[model samples]
Target: MKASLRLQDTAIRYFLEVAQIGSISEASVRLNVAPSAISRQISSLEDILGAVLFERQPRGMKLSAAGEMLAAYARKNALESARVVAEIDALNGIEKGHINIACSEGFAMDFIPRTLSNFRQQHPGIHFNLKVCAPAEVATLISRGDADIGITLSLSPTKDIKVEYRQPSPIMAVFHPTHPLAHKKTVSLSQLQPYPIALPEENTTVRQLFDICCSRLNLLFEPILESNHMASLSRFTAFGGGIHLSGEISMRHQIATEELIAVPIRDRGMDVRNIEIQTLSGRTLPNIIKVFLAYLIVKMKHEETIGF
Candidate 1:
């Protein structure tokens, strides 16, 4: 777009800094540049665009009418610039970059860490920032540019969000290997009625499925312990006590080690849903991120096909 052509990258940076912090001095401290240098850049930008970008006040600067319009263009340009930098680095056979991810707590437990470790073996210089969030917030985080990618269950499609990959990720009954129903490979809603249970909070997708299935089977649902944290639920299930309901992937490590067991909740399609890999729509991703994303997608697809 012609939006970024109005000013040099430095000028756009300076203008954005002032607009964000509402003060040149604050932005200078953050940018590690002199205040006067930032001021001169802002002045030059305004002159070039022939629009007043800020309104100076005794308190602090504020965005003018023109400033708001430039803000979108400036941030988009900056993100594109970062993409360009990463691509240039790739040309030299370098795979160094930092990627931020926001995802569901379920993926945070096992899938993400394992994937990150595997990917980094090929590009040790690549770093990752992972944050646990609800599935519903995944699209928002990517669209708002808070994260490079999102991995979450039951992620809804949106206009500004692109689904890179999605696969079946159903809720399951998780408990200790020594538990009564542990010998069984799968369980029905009726089977869980007799056990003391640890359930995720009602807001979570796992709990929502549990509630819906129980209602369909005319079963009463009660939990001895309810929490939003997967680790807490995992630890509870690790001990010799109640069965905790969760997605199979969240506790796959424990299941593999025999610290816990995961049994699918039985139904024709009761817990049917997808785990989605997502990104901001129409944004060109950095090569480093693209590489990692491709690996993640293929790995996840493999999991779906073979229960990895």
Candidate 2:
């Protein structure tokens, strides 16, 4: 019924705080207790366990071998304590929970915002934390337990993350509503060769794909305006700067408002940009995560079916 009792033991809590903070005064400040009290607690813990948990240093305290083992135990205990509290919350019909998600930059603008909107509407008590990084960094977030869920351009054969759902997400040629190429129902990569283009930076994954695709088709990509950020390119196209190429999710709202139009790029090599949902492999998902994931999958399916 309480908020779990795992770390309430004063000495254990003090040691954990010191171990986490690497300084007695810092731990005291964080715990809102006296420095002398924290030092005594740490000393008492050391005496009882018969382990020199920290090595005093001029810079700060460093964890000893014994301290590392105890720190692992403390971390495990913290997780267990959280599970107990979550279980109690569930038993009382409380829907409150927190979800951490990692995703590529595009999802931050449109896909994640919409998904969070729909999810929060039903479970208003729940909270969400979002981290946007490069597509390659998404898997690392999950594997390192930094994120409960990830959505990114497909990263197949992942190291420690598992793909739960994946669907085709082809890159599209985006341009202003009144651009010459906007009148056509579908646009190909070759059609834009004559005009100035806005392309992602040379080192980015999308740019690499564009380069490889251009090489395969013997098409030259010379961009007058080059940027690493997808949002900037979308802005450039919306203002009638030049045609840009990218996945459709980032520009969904703009396209809906007729600010920008997404025309299908009919290139075989660069067409495959499957959107994937991933989680840490062999990890049990929290209930809130499962519910949100369901919401996301439903949204993704609808988008695929109706081109949302």
Candidate 3:
């Protein structure tokens, strides 16, 4: 019985690690076990469950339907375990816990950092683990139970993410105040086409909307610079030659400091994006996460009302 139980635990652990990392070799490295051992454990899990968990692909392993189901179960189990630990800590009168948050680069720039700083002032014992990624990966991390909270720009509803708070995050024209279009209250894509542009990569929601709008008008504008990092793009725009597109909230600090100006874009579909505060669906959250969620929502809303 002991041996069987140990095998089951090992199989589940290895399987979950593989599922999260999406590669047996990478999971082995992360788990500090041999790739062959991880492979064997996964095979044992597949045999016991009588289902193929992963699809072997040239690029990497992709989860099969059965694997996705198992992954969901494992994530719920892990969250429940954390809740138990938190409860025990609370019983011991300890005010400590870790919050894992995943968000896109835009939020990481100023809003999240400031919010975290202010939150720690009251709950200094609490710690945070923040992972910055693309908008889609933020949802993936939350759904997999790797992150306790997810804040991102979503073009549509995700499969298993629950939106605790959402606000419209329209993309705006971000540039230095001295730029030719800065004096205008709103700018059009065609009006700005004559100047050099710095744009986010094609994968981002901002670029997607811009592409769709351009496609509709048969307009063609090639950016002088393209990057995934919001900081780099902001800095490039700050140097005073070109403009970058971003949500007003993302660059609120810079705008307040008089380093940049954000004008509403006069294009349709530019306002289709939303900033979502997300978590895994149907999971009971720890008190620490609940408090922080409320705090974050209030802060975001307050900032939305205050002008630059």
Candidate 4:
């Protein structure tokens, strides 16, 4: 059979819903299909695709490797179909729907709130489910269809995830106002050598970037404290124990509150990973997600241009 003929819409949808819910019974409930119907459709889909989609477990079904690939394709196709319908609806001037997004805690706390608040005001009928997680976890959530959108620092792309937006945000040194280095408008990596530093834990992207930069400058970067959480890092910096490095946006509120001073590390060329907005490749975002992404792109561009 032809590849197109092998995958029917009903089968594809059943597979997609099952993948989303991670259980045949739950998918049946969500899609309003009988459990047997869902199972039969998924089995037919597996046969057509020439791969098993799920493995039975005592509690729930788990996706097999083949299932993951097919699920990604199914999600992309469903999203595209919805986008087409939304476009048709737009001709009648009716805007609607919800968007589920997964993002890192840093962006969730500072950047996303303002942008989403603005989006909600403009499209009150649209709903948002924002899940805050680490960058790797955010990527996994999007891959599993638990989230429609993801915002995170640039990393190696997963098989079908597309990087839609990448905004460069600088990593700046933060210190309490009373700290000696806080008086300097710009500091070099060498200037920080004398002070104890609070840094992200070793495996994180931020810590890796900081390590690479310091190594290039032949500067010693021994941290007195380390944490995976940005909030904790900021608190440590604010308490006057040690300096910390963080994204400019993540520390905006604390800086405004005068709890800490942010100094640009001019000589070290302190640039953090490119902030990215990602979606499954070949997919169309829902109207709410599409609009929110457009808004985010605009806001990030504005911030980039204005040096925020």
Candidate 5:
């Protein structure tokens, strides 16, 4: 018996590059092949797969329905290939595989670095690709299969994905150490009313929680400064500008090093939100991810029990 030759791998790789670049010519340039040769390969792929992979457009080529399906399969194959290569590299005691992660700016800045540093030390051959986006954007990236894992706060678990809830982190009100309310161990919602609050824009989980808390206390809760970035809020709060609200895990270092104080809000009943680890449903996690997630869970548990 003779072994079978397969163009599936080759075709999928070619189309992945083409889809990424959106132009056969550009893909050829990147692939170091002639434009005509790339075109021939695409045509051959289409014939072999018995479906058209791209729709010609005046600007460039777009993936057709069948093309989209193939592209998805190709992406999964690419990830699996990287995983296999990483496993092979691990035999040499090197961690040389790529992991793409999506997280919010706060987590990326404060938490992920230490975790990744430890992960890197343990698996020196692993490469990391990180994107810092809003929680909703992170969710979208995970759903679209662009990210292998997502970490976010206050996210409602959805059936579209599998979610592992980490320990909840308290959302606290932060102010400059010298501020009037800084002396208090806990602050009421009415006490926050005297100061201008700098908060994330409307529709964010943090903002929504803030609003509900304010409404319950019959406070207006108008923000003097609105931003999407938590770091900006931290900066503003550090300077004695206004009160800013964030998770205790996110503000731990800032509170310690920047002369900022975090007072827990008691009256409004704002509960801690669980930071979630999310992935596409039914997808088997690579060993690297499994190890990393285990580490994350352990670390989060420690953080939850110990004040940061």
Candidate 6:
């Protein structure tokens, strides 16, 4: 007996590439095949499956209902295939694999690197790829299967992404320990007015939360400086230059080292954010990823208990 589908078939590979790229021309460039060839392959796949996979758009292809289902199937099959190969390698006394992670800059600055360093010490053969991106882009990477894991502070819920872990991550007032507000158990938005505030861009989740809170109270503020990089902002506050707004996790190292202090903001709107660990929906992750994920959860939980 022979299997109905062959894993090495070029038609399915082209179809999946087109589905991911959303354009035959783009997929052609990536796959080093002619656009016509990719088109023919996708059309053949549609005929064989008896369903129109994509709705032809003027600019590019949009996956139809059938396309989405098939994409999901392809992703799961690819992950399973990789897992089997890794298991085989392990049986032969070889251990090696790659894990891709996409996350916001907040985590990249300290926590993620620390975690990865520790994980590598345990499994030296397991490699990693880390992508620092916007919070929303983290979800996009996960949904597209470009990343195996995503850690981000989310402003709103995103669809087609599974939340593996979640914790309340509030926008805290970050400043040098010697700053006047540092001694307070909790500080409100009104109390933050006097100091020089260095804020992230208005588009960031941290800034949005701060802006919403100020709008409700009818308070006005002009930041001394605005930046997209949270690391720079944290550094500015760490040197006692000014105050910055961020989550505790982003400045965890700074707080731990006593270089900067993170005081909770006593406002409901400012507290309305969460740190989420995300993955593609309906996908079974590789065993290596599961192990790393458990390690991440334990580390994060331990940090929470320490009360930075």
Clashes per candidate (backbone, < 3 Å): 0, 0, 0, 0, 4, 0
List the lowest-lDDT window of 10 residues for candidate 5.
Answer: 1-10
Model 1: per-residue Cα lDDT over 103-206, one tens digit each: 99989998899899998888899989998887888776675566899998872466577888877777788878888898897888788889999888866788
Winner of 4 and 6 under TM-score: 6
lDDT of 3 by residue, 1-308 (tens): 34324437678899999888889889988999999998998898787777899999987889999999988987788798899899899899999999999999989999999999999999999999999999989988898898999999999999988999998998999989899889798998998899999999987999999999999978899899999888899999999869999998789789989899999998888899999999999899998889999999999889777752
- Choose 5 or 6, whichever is better by lDDT: 6
User: Which ranges of candidate 5 are over 4 A from the true structure?
Assistant: 1-74, 215-218, 267-269
Model 1 vs. true fold: TM: 0.77
Query: Per-residue lDDT tens digits of candidate 6, residues 239-296?
Result: 7789999988888777888888888899888888898998888887777888888999
Alpha carbon lDDT at 30, candidate 4: 90
In model 2, where do residues sit more than 4 Å from their true spots?
Answer: 1-84
lDDT (Cα) of model 6: 0.86
Model 2 backbone overlap count = 0
lDDT of 1 at 298: 87
Q: Tell me, what's the RMSD of every candidate?
A: 5.1, 6.1, 2.4, 4.2, 4.4, 2.5
Q: Per-residue error at 68 for model 5, in Å?
A: 7.3
Candidate 4 runs further than 4 Å off: 1-44, 52-68, 81-93, 155-159, 214-222, 266-269
For 149-213, candidate 4 gives per-residue lDDT tens digits of 89887646566688888877667888899998897978888888899999987656677778888
How far is 105's C-alpha from truth in model 2 (Å)?
0.9
Estimate the lDDT of model 1: 0.83
Tell me each candidate's TM-score.
0.77, 0.74, 0.93, 0.77, 0.75, 0.91
True-structure lDDT of candidate 5: 0.77
Estimate every model's Cα lDDT from 0 to 1. 0.83, 0.80, 0.90, 0.79, 0.77, 0.86
Ranking by TM-score: 3, 6, 4, 1, 5, 2
Runs off by more than 4 Å, candidate 3: 1-7, 56-60
Error (Å) of candidate 6 at residue 279 is 2.6
Query: Once model 6 is optimally superposed onto the true structure by TM-score, how far is the C-alpha of residue 230 displaced, in angstroms?
Result: 0.9
